[model samples]
Target: MLINVPENVVPDALRGFAAVHTDLTVDVERRVIVRRGAPYDGQVGLVSGGGSGHEPLHGGFVGRGMLTAACPGEVFTSPVPDQMVRAAAAVDSGAGVLFIVKNYTGDVLNFDMAAELAEDEGVQVAKVLVNDDVAVTDSLYTAGRRGTGATLFVEKLAGAAADEGAPLDRVAGIARRVNEASRSFGVALSACSTPAKGGPTFDLPEGELELGVGIHGEPGRERRAMMTSGEIADVSVDAVVDDLQPDAPVLLLVNGMGATPLLELYGFAAEVHRAMGARKVSVARTLVGNYVTSLDMAGASVTICQADEELLRLWDAPVSTPALRWGC
Candidate 1:
């Protein structure tokens, strides 16, 4: 089957999604630029966004403990600085705002521009660029590699730091540490995220998988014959474990790309857990969900971060975001 989704339609529908969430509200004319009131006095606010296709991300993360505002753009496209500028202004309390941007080129460029624009308005701005996906490590084509599942970890941790009245630089520094210590690896079975692009993002007949897959349906690092779910989990997670140190305990994120259902995600997580135990690794905290995704890719990824004391503390703090809320 084939489908061609209209450009403006999805963004329009997302406006309603924004309205329904108490922690978020959409600026219809601006697409999914949802706002959440700041949580404290004189506390630096967090504002983050990118394209809307990766839902419950920048927008879903808006709340008292997370982002104050999110500037969502069209599907798979970066938001303009103007939208971010608007969000920055709205969410700015007396302190400042920190922008959590993925390391993609368009995202990096636009967010950096927005920070500069916000500075001109006398808003103290800091940024933490996330690039934890080990899939595409080359910096030649894109700006290094794409930011993947670990963003959720960064968001919650940073939000916690901000909630406790940490300065912009300190919050951003912790976010950077999360991004640095973490690593992700994934495998894709089928793809179809954009509603218009109905069928799989790419044509993958039965008995094949793309390893090291990306969120935008881009090519992966390896294409191989299909394997069992347990094997798939082992292979994907092994790549991440290989890069991590043996002594450190990790904060784990087992994420379904999108189309992968919870039934399968649970099984995958179990496999990843089993694999870690076999290596005598300890898990400090864990998250499993559709964190960063293509429209609907039938796959899952494993993210492992060797957590430090500060990072773990921040992760345990209160957060009140739309997609995730706890503690406070």
Candidate 2:
């Protein structure tokens, strides 16, 4: 409800975000953000993009051992092919580029167009479409599952592979594997108000919540009466676990949907952990914070990625990004 501006919010916010990171370079003209000295010359490049408001996703992820560049569009709007083309070119190190595309129709079409354009420019390009959200099989904006938290997994795992000098195809394959093994479900306590919309995207009356909501503030599978935190935790974890059908150790990511406070996130994470234990699910790794977010939406999502020895090794690899930094 309280953004700095009523228009041009994305560019204005990007200026501030770029100013804070010395390792990042913002190409205002192209609306592309890249990590300094990325692509590492001969290493396969990783590039991804989507609507703007999901901060710290594609943007914060641009750094060593992660993404080479990220293209951000206006809030909830997909970046154009030109933006992706430029970003891919900047990060291509003679080793080709891999575009980590979310399954949203706009994102898929734009990234596909960019890939073709880049190929014409003599750059080898590959794509891995992410559709790991278990919220809905089809939505108003997408034909399949809406990509959600698993986009982070795909970027990190695939980026680590690329940073290790894996070829474009291999990196894309890793991204696909991560997506196939991950599932996510979200619950929204309140709707988000975008600067452009100037009001809540959707209305959630008091004493009610939307279960299995999308990150773009889209209506979820169903609406339910608001329950206790522990009860909400049960529902969220149950949905993901049922869909994932994990047979091995798991990586649990409890993510906040932007405006939720840290205090509440941590509390919710604890409840989720307990729920997993009751189900005899083994959680080998855990991340609790706001990673993939829907701007200022007061809700949380639980993402469970089936992790094996190989996935665990990649997950533990060093990564340094603005929103997530570790093993560096």
> What's the CA error at residue 7 for candidate 1, in Å?
2.4
- Residues 241-277, candidate 2: write the lDDT tens digits: 8888899989889999998998999999999999999
Per-residue lDDT, model 2, residue 4, is 74
Per-residue lDDT for 1-328 in model 1, tens only? 2233475655665656755775566777865454555435778878888876777777778776667777787777788999888887777786888888987888999999989999999888889888878877566775687788878888888888888888888888888988888888978888654655644567776788899987777768788999988898778777887876647789999988788899988888888888888778888888888878777778888998888788888788787766777777
Best by TM-score: 2
Runs in model 2 lying further than 4 Å from the true structure: 1-4, 138-142
Query: In model 2, what is the error at residue 250, expressed in angstroms?
Result: 0.9
User: In candidate 1, which residue ranges exceed 4 Å CA deviation?
Assistant: 1-5, 32-35, 140-142, 193-199
| Worst-scoring 10-residue span by lDDT in model 2 | 133-142
Give the RMSD in angstroms, all C-alphas superposed, for model 1: 2.3
Clashing pairs in 2: none
